[model samples]
Target: MDMKLEVVILPVSDVDRAKDFYAGRLGWRLDADFPIEDGYRIVQVTPPGSACSVIFGEGLTGQQAGTLHGLQLTVTDIVKAQEELASCGVEVSGPFRDETGAFHHAGDARRVPGAHPERASYGTFAAFEDPDGNAWFLQEVTERAPGR
Candidate 1:
């Protein structure tokens, strides 16, 4: 059995604002926007070149807005990715590599000043957030592990 991950539901306080941030600021494609009964709604957006999508809307998730953290997006060029997002008015963090050349922490203490010198896969990252403060990270991956 092969199971492929699909949609992730983001809990957001304001539906319209989240929509604007993802679809406008982050440049994700708006896959769907429709209404459910009793003022509920469903909005789905897909990041470019990603098979998975994220959804947020009224009454869609029971989790608190701004609580989700450490969601990741992979990029090939860390510098270009940071520049593009910053140009779109998003507050992206500067690219940083882990001190140990391994996984980084969700907090600020482990950050080094620049991308990995070797440019190894999964070694460098920058972070940002949605309007409701759900954090997301951009990781630079120049090579995939076997079978990836």
Candidate 2:
């Protein structure tokens, strides 16, 4: 059996605000947005060149508005991604490097304590949160130098 992860569901209070944040601020492509019934809406978005997409809508199963947590999105360059998000008025947390390489946050300026350096073999990583308090991470990794 071949199985693949396809979509992730995010909970939000307002669909329009979430749409603007993911699409307008973060630059995620709007995949779908429409109403299903009784004024409920369904919205989906995909990050640039990503296989999995995020889904948010009214009345999702076992998901409460503004109750989601710890959804990480990886990026190629942490610094560049942080800069871009900062330019869009999103608060970026850190670029701190210790024995465990470097890590940061996207929204708040705080280093996630106890992050080991060996965990970061690539470049570095950071985190941020959307307007709805949805947390995300921007990871940077060094390209493997040819063949070791």
lDDT of each: 0.90, 0.71
Candidate 1 global lDDT: 0.90
User: Candidate 1 — which pairs collide?
Assistant: none
TM values, all candidates: 0.96, 0.76
> CA lDDT of 13 in candidate 2?
81
**How many residue-pair clashes does candidate 2 contain?**
14
Per-residue lDDT tens digits for candidate 2, residues 91-141, read 976554333244443344444443235545443556678777877765655
Q: Which one is best on lDDT?
A: 1
Show model 1 residue runs off by greater than 4 Å. Answer: none
After superposing candidate 2, which stretches have Cα over 4 Å from the reference? Answer: 97-123, 144-148
Q: What digit string (tens of lDDT, one per residue) describes model 1 on residues 96-133?
A: 98788898886767799888888888899999988899
Candidate 1, run of 10 with poorest lDDT: 101-110
